[model samples]
Target: MSINCRTRAQRRNQVPLRIVALRFDFETSPQKIEQQLITFLRELRWKARGFDPADLEAAREADDWSDELLACSPSRHDSDKIRRRAQALADRRLRASGMAHLDKDAREKLRGLSDGVRVVQLPSAHRADEIAATLHDEMPWMAQATTLAWHAMRESVRSGAPALHLPPMLLDGPPGIGKSYWARRLAQLIGTPSEMIDAANEPAGFAVAGSQRGWATAQPGRPVELFLRERVGNPIMVIDEIDKVGDVLSNKGVNFALSNALLPLLEPLSAKAWSCPYFRVTFDMRWISWILTSNNRR
Candidate 1:
């Protein structure tokens, strides 16, 4: 393989003043070689465009075109192209309504949901610490968890990265442990909207993740509905009796399971690109904090 390096000024001027070039033959599979070439060309393009190499590497490793677009594009217009491409791919899979066909009600609902998907920006580390302290004081048993959560929040703030320190927490204990109460209390303390899903009664997973539009009685997912109603992105979602979630066979002859549906929402990467079954649009869902309570450890 051979690579050519050029000065930023030369790159800006579209000058081909190559500094150095090296060549090598690799004894690798054809597919591997093809992937390597593609990666090398992508890095070259990003560098030529004067984008941060680290950002390019991160986007490539994560397979996130949106991040890559943000790194390379200087204007929203350029980034929109990348976003549109991603949406097109998602549309191909789901065959959902396009943005052009979205009615006013659907657009308004989506706008409301988008507001709820964004992270709650904190002012400073001091405020984050204060919130943590208050949470610990209110729920003495969760002191350790609160401390860690605040530390993570402060670190994220300091580093100028999205706050993703707090992962979905599953509180497990016997009955009468105030598990549900604590979840609600935490949400109240954080000053965000909260919703409880009674998994024991609502066994169908579609209630949580939403049913596809083609299905009868289809509607937006619980989280989307909560966001639309509360008009907040970072709501506290508490799933009660999660272990008691029952399986159900859908009208499409597919088995729907709560745990399976919740998996993407619980993970940061997948949640960042979550596609709503109803709206059929992909949106970030990493802002929502999840709390699950189960009587049995399993």
Candidate 2:
């Protein structure tokens, strides 16, 4: 990697690293586990009441169900109500089962994000304009991009947004023009955390879109790691030399492409409920600021 980007102030606010250990049930309290078991049993009994397979079979043969089983549900039949309830329970179980790929350590790492990341908001519109002035001086070559950033900041300020969120930007320019550096600088000025990804080095979309659990190298993507590391919801992500990324990277008979993987994250609606392939967890990644720098249009 020829480029190294750094932002002003560089408020990394990086959390201390934690070494994950082996998985063990003893890690949790017996009382808590017992309580969970009790709750599950109670719910299971409630759902099973008057809805046993044997009872249903007998009712089918006799063509006469008990009053409780034949009662009409508000929106449907009693059987329909139980079916919906059972289906809902099954859905929750399936979702939890999908997380089987994650280890205890990985699960713990993601648990911290329950409260969500912090939001960095602009102090005022005037401050945004001032920052824009300073940006023009720092990298005059990126003036047009700077102006776009300025407008985004002004809009954020005017609307009293919780964070200074910017739209996805493509910096089309020749190399050695400080496009990557300027992106980091913008993150600093906006007080949002940032991560830089070299697309030339990425063999798959794991850097941003996340690697699946069954993959040889399975792990969460930068966006998820950013939220965990910086504790910020909206972070500036710079994908340097995106045009240099390969059309596709294949392994274990599975193909992955950075461009194709980014489609969901780039779209606002999909981004709001973006799911990480690593942990099988959904997250709202709408506020992520993307700056894709390219040397050519490829």
Candidate 3:
């Protein structure tokens, strides 16, 4: 009899057998393993109480708005006014697009953007410490920089002011040393979205400060774009390869340099009342965290 059958017969007959060593080999093909893993995941998903479908749909709609807001050049767009109008229009469009079930209060808030100026609510000092710790964990080599930044952020937060002004950071280092990466990671750690501009390729300095409304294809500047997309005044704006920004000569035989365009924006006083060419409105942009990354060591 086969060993398996003998073992079963002995068990059924209530018989005691001599002690013996037994060995068994188990094997699974790659395909079978993959299938088992997939089954396990599906079972887990079925057991978990996942996100509500309505909430998921709302998040998708918000994501779509964010993407669209980031893609357009806001040359002539106004700051709060234009953004409010745009948001109202978007809310209408969303309603027309079968989201009639959206909360009435939310719709009213979008419409209310047109009536009042909204200030960004700064996070607490405790939150800033959490962000700093996360940054240190992500990039241990940047401990000094992160610590200083955290101190600044914490101080700003502790002041209990509605607006928080953060100093602009100019990161000078060689290529591949993670300067740009640090900026991006910092934004993520702070729980804010970031927008990166390649100054080397976009030679038009107007793109940073925005074109005048009289000019064709004029839009709002990069700062306005961040505020509109993220609905916050303090988003991180990263200008990569700032050292390589090129100068362009206009039709009037005037040379426009990127540094010249950035000078006013970088200054705290000037940035406090930065004018938007599109809406022709002055916006307080001191809260924005500007990060300029360059390959130049100097």
Candidate 4:
């Protein structure tokens, strides 16, 4: 092959992960590849090893998707243990929905998360320094907030966390100074998915803690759904206009301010076992980085 051709082929080899079917090669015969997969699966453990292509019609009639999980999980997470955990959760969701079999929409909705929650590789000191310098240049006015994020990022790395986890940060300053923007940029550098919630729109705080299943508008919290969509365990969440989160009361006379909703999630122990009101499932949300922004320290 020419130099360019060789380089391209090498890159392609690395592009695909070491997952189920990806282990096969063009050079290997089908019989040999099948044997290789069997041996590999024998060692790996879990359901994929037992998936028989010969039973395709039977599996199709039954409407199962376990075999296909092998095809997509390599990009989701690297740990087989985590993959199993995610698989269990996905199975529960499917069973609870009372679906007779799996379909495209179900697969798409739970795609990344059904695979696993990926713990992103922490940033190195050099990378951290680069991000700090960039943030400083872009939003010089939020230096203190920037410093806290920088320190937290470094501490998480030192503490040997699987992913970059920053402590919940409350940034207080005048509006229009790019505090939320800075938080988002930091998430980008750290390679975590992020979401921005305008507290002004969420008086009841259900957007953060999720609502009871009995409620007509019930659904999983942003953090849970974000994890499912992005497959990242440590996603950045920016709560903009936190001071505007009203002290709304329900008919029963209970306050549901966003700040109250955040207490359980902010507490390390409580967050580790947070139960979603909508899904009725416990989730470990401690690793999520929360950045709450406000116009003033009210």
* Residue 171 lDDT in candidate 4: 89
Candidate 1 stretches with Cα past 4 Å from truth are: 1-97, 101-104, 111-118, 162-165, 251-253
- Please give, for residues 175-249, the per-residue lDDT of candidate 2 as tens digits: 999999998888777777788888888846888888777778777888788777766777788998888877674
Give the clashing residue pairs of candidate 4, or none: none
Question: What stretches of model 2 exceed 4 Å from their correct place?
Answer: 1-29, 33-102, 251-254
* Candidate 1 clashes between residue pairs 3 or more apart in a chain or in different chains: 1-24, 116-232, 116-233
In candidate 2, the residue pairs with backbone N, CA or C atoms under 3 Å apart (3 or more residues apart, or in different chains) clash, namely none
Taking the tens digit of each residue's C-alpha lDDT, what string does model 4 give over 103-179? 44533454334435565545466666776778888888888977887787777767766667788899888888888
**Poorest stretch of ten by lDDT in candidate 2:** 18-27
Stretches of candidate 4 off by over 4 Å are: 1-112
Candidate 3 per-residue lDDT over residues 161-184, each given as its tens digit: 554445888887778878778887
- On lDDT, the candidate that comes out on top is 2
- Evaluate model 1: give its lDDT: 0.63
**How many steric clashes does model 3 contain?**
9
Give each prediction's root-mean-square deviation over alpha carbons: 19.2, 13.3, 26.4, 14.3
Candidate 3 deviant stretches above 4 angstroms = 1-123
Q: On a 0 to 1 TM-score scale, where does candidate 3 land against the true structure?
A: 0.58
Sort by TM-score, best first: what order? 2, 4, 1, 3
